[model samples]
Target: MSATRPTLKLTHSGALQALDGALRKAEELGVPQNITVVDEGGNLLAYVRMDGAKLLSRETSMSKAITASSHRQPTSRLDPRNEIKLAIAGGGRLTNLEGGLPIIIDGHCVGAIGVGSGTGEQDVEVARAGLAAIGAEDQKP
Candidate 1:
């Protein structure tokens, strides 16, 4: 057998610092939000919910991360398009909701960040901070 070196599929791995970065953004934005980080496989890596954050944000954050990680698409893609329904109906993992973004590096998808409790726009901004903090590319729209 030929020897092969192990390589990581996702360039950016989830980190607790990412969660902190997101929380900092939430504080800066004057909003409390629940944030989640997940690996390429949609497995939770780190999570944090600020005080006064909406309770529903917990599930939103988790689902967002899962959608971004598994679908390699931003949660915004969960637009009521039929594609989203298929993704959910096929038993494919994805939050199909807004406020989630995929972490990328060198044009490669690494992981994902999910933010909730704030407006969709604010959630994107907060999630961007987390990705940037962890050295992940944030070329989100």
Candidate 2:
């Protein structure tokens, strides 16, 4: 058998820091939002919904987080047509929104953050704050 390879992963403490950062930004913007943080494997690591945030944003935030992690890039990279196709036929595995950002550390994608319930720009801003808290590079659109 071949030797096992090591890989990076986001820790619970890191996820908490990301969540706190996102919430702080949302508060500064005075916009309630739902935020999701996912691991490199596209699994949820942390999530939160501010009071008064639209309930509908919950799933969208999660989807955005998963899409970013799975693609190892921001969701904004997807074209509108592709976004529609993926939403309708690709099992919602992707999104074409600006609120999702990959968490890159040491040139590697360790996770992602997605924020919803505000304008795309606002959401992305919040997500960027989250990434920054973890000392991850921002992958803004």
Compute the lDDT of residue 65 as modeled in candidate 1. Answer: 85
Q: What is the lDDT, from 0 to 100, of the residue 59 in candidate 1?
A: 84
For residues 1-141, could you state the per-residue lDDT of candidate 2 as single tens digits? 869967888998899999999999999999999999999988888999999999989988988888888888888997776677778775875777778899999988988898999999899999999998889997658
Model 1 lDDT per residue over 10-125, tens place? 43334687888898989999999999888878877788889999998898898888888777778777557676675667475556667888888677776788999998899999
TM-scores for all candidates: the values are 0.83, 0.93
Clashing pairs in 2: none
- For model 1 the TM-score comes to 0.83
RMSD of each candidate relative to the true structure? 3.1, 1.6
Pick out the ten consecutive residues of candidate 1 with the lowest summed lDDT.
5-14
Go through the candidates in order and give the clash count of each. 1, 0
Candidate 2: list runs displaced more than 4 Å. 1-3
Q: What local lDDT score does residue 138 receive in model 1, on the 0 to 100 scale?
A: 70
lDDT of 1 at 54: 99
On lDDT, the candidate that comes out on top is 2
lDDT of each: 0.80, 0.89
